[model samples]
Target: RSAGVSKAHDPRHAAKMFKSAQEDKTGRWLAIHFTSHDNPHISRDALEELIQDMSKQSYRQEILAEDDEIQLSWLVYRAFNERTNKIDDFEIPKNWLVYVGHDFGGANPAALFVAQDPATGNFYEFKEYLPGAGHSTAQHVDMFKELTTGYSVIWRSGGSHQEGEIRQGYSSHGWPIVEPKINSVKAQVDKVVGTMELNKVFIFKSLHNRLTEVMNCLWAPDAEGIPTDKIKDEEKYHLSACARYLYCNFTPDTVVHNKSRTSHSMSM
Candidate 1:
């Protein structure tokens, strides 16, 4: 039986459920994937209670912990143990690809993408490419290439003409490219829903960091359900990358007004 393991008010109560599942012959291989929020402490009191409950069970089980830091650590751990092993440490759907940035060029613009798992209908933040404190676009591109040599990438030019400028710059380096066709907020959300539906994808809230920003950044105009302008007036490369993912991945049935009008237009 599948269950979302989290901090339970009563550990004893949760134990009973596990016990019942174990009795069923078909439920012996219980894979309890941890989708709950994990804090710094490896063994929190509440977490220990759940662990203890699982330990008591005689049936075979496995714990697949899923979280941001934990997932990253999992990648490293798997790589170390499975060096030379035929199996890959990480998995992403074939259709899904990385989304590249073309706004702030180097310092502030964020390069991000979503990898939707077709089987589970879940989207992982996949990876992000951010320019460092004093790095140029060329440097960031070089680093990005190094970081994502084998991974498929999807590029986006979303910031009016500025996006065009980013495109020209990255093109010099031969990055696999695509254009952001999303022209409106409604379209952006629609693209998200459609992409999820099209690819059987669900945004992995517990795993993806950008989801938090996406959820927080979106707002309504006067409660009529119309989207207001995106949050701006500062450097938000990472946040913008998330926004662009929503913009590019899904194509909506009804398009929202594309806010492609920005002061920093790329004339090329």
Candidate 2:
């Protein structure tokens, strides 16, 4: 007898059946539980593509054989490092350019504090804030002001849904702001992939909220089980949107000045 367990079947029931079969030692019995990651026939390139395209839940259940409530898998965890990238909190160098990326949704407004290393051109996301629901724009601005008191911050806004209102709110409080022309979603995602591949992005170890978003954001799947460019789990992607805006819009030449701290804007 042989048994296999998949997302289509109950793992608990499969375990019970396998245990019962094991007790009946009169006949040869084999039980196998496997996911896509378990298959020896898959090529390395194919596996990487599959992982890049699959949703988190799909990857966990179909590739790792683990049942995760979130159907989509994260797109970034494979590249992020807690030791090298995710470092301990430290004072950002005075010469480093600092910027804030904002995803402006009234229900769950998200912001990320990013700093660029002048010498290496690498970017570090050091802090994140997600104030959920019922918070006014003034309140959000106040919070940001408190966090970025001394730094000269160049604010980048994502999503045109409430762009005008958000800009006004920040501008009223004397926050310097700009809206970079939005690129195609695929282009933004590709930029992130390229940065990660080159090991140019980093995060502070204490920014758990942003890390969680990075680990949970997933691509939506079509009826034929193909991953689409559309992202699933909108509620969990606020911080990701902020990161994408900064990644797609801000570059070393554009945002970082040699020593004068001059600011420039460019669109990806």
Best-performing candidate as measured by TM-score? 2
What TM-score against the true fold does each predicted structure earn? 0.45, 0.66
Off by over 4 Å in 2: 1-83, 251-268
Distance from true position, residue 120, model 2, in Å?
1.1
Decoy 1 TM-score against native? 0.45
| lDDT of candidate 2 over 1-268, digit per residue (tens) | 5477354222234445655676766777765667776688988788898888776646766678654332323343345554477677788876676778878776888888988776766777888998789987677778988887777665455665447766777778766456645556666666566666667788887888777666656676676455567777655678888877667664433433243432335531
lDDT of each: 0.43, 0.66
* Model 1 stretches with alpha carbons more than 4 Å out: 1-90, 93-106, 116-123, 154-158, 196-209, 220-237, 240-268
Going through the candidates in the order shown, the clash numbers are 11, 6
What pairs collide in candidate 2?
Answer: 55-73, 56-72, 56-73, 57-71, 57-72, 57-73
